[model samples]
Target: MNLDLLKRTRMYKGYNQYQMAEGIGLTRQTYNYKENGKSSFNSDELLRITTFLDLSFKEVNEIFFDNLISK
Candidate 1:
C-alpha cells in the first residue's frame, strides 16, 4: 500500500489520523494501519478516502493504483 502518500496527504490537509479516519468513516486504528503500511484497503475504503480527501478520481487512481493495471 502507498502508505507514504496516505500520510503525506493527510498532513498536507492538516489532519491527524484520527480526524481523517472519522472524516472517511473508518476506525482510527484501521486508518492508522493503512497509513503505517500494515494493511490494504478494500474498494469501499478507497472510495471513502478519495471522497473525504476531496481528490479527483484521477488523483486517487494515481496515488493508490500504482500497482494495478487494466485487464
Candidate 2:
C-alpha cells in the first residue's frame, strides 16, 4: 500500500491515528497496522476510510490501486 499520501492528508486534517481510526469505526491498533502496510484493507474498511477521509474515487485509486493500474 502506498500510504504516503494518506499520511500527509491525515496530518493536514489534524487527525491523529486514533482519531482517524475511530472516525472510520476501527481500533487504533488495526488502523496502525493497516497504515503501516502490515495488513491490506478489506472492501468495507476501504469504504469506511474513504468516507472518513472524504476521498474521491480517483484519489482512492491513486493511493491504493497504483499497483493494479501498473499491471
Top candidate when judged by TM-score against the true structure: 2
Q: Any runs in candidate 2 off by more than 4 Å, and if so which?
A: 67-71
| Tens digit of per-residue lDDT, candidate 2, span 7-71 | 88787878999999999898999999989888887989888888888887677877778646642
lDDT of candidate 1? 0.81
Residue 7, model 1, lDDT: 80
| Alpha-carbon lDDT, every model | 0.81, 0.83
Q: Write the per-residue lDDT of candidate 1 for residues 1-71, one digit (tens) a residue.
A: 46787788779988998999898888999888888878888889888888888876556765788646444
Candidate 1 similarity to native, TM-score: 0.80
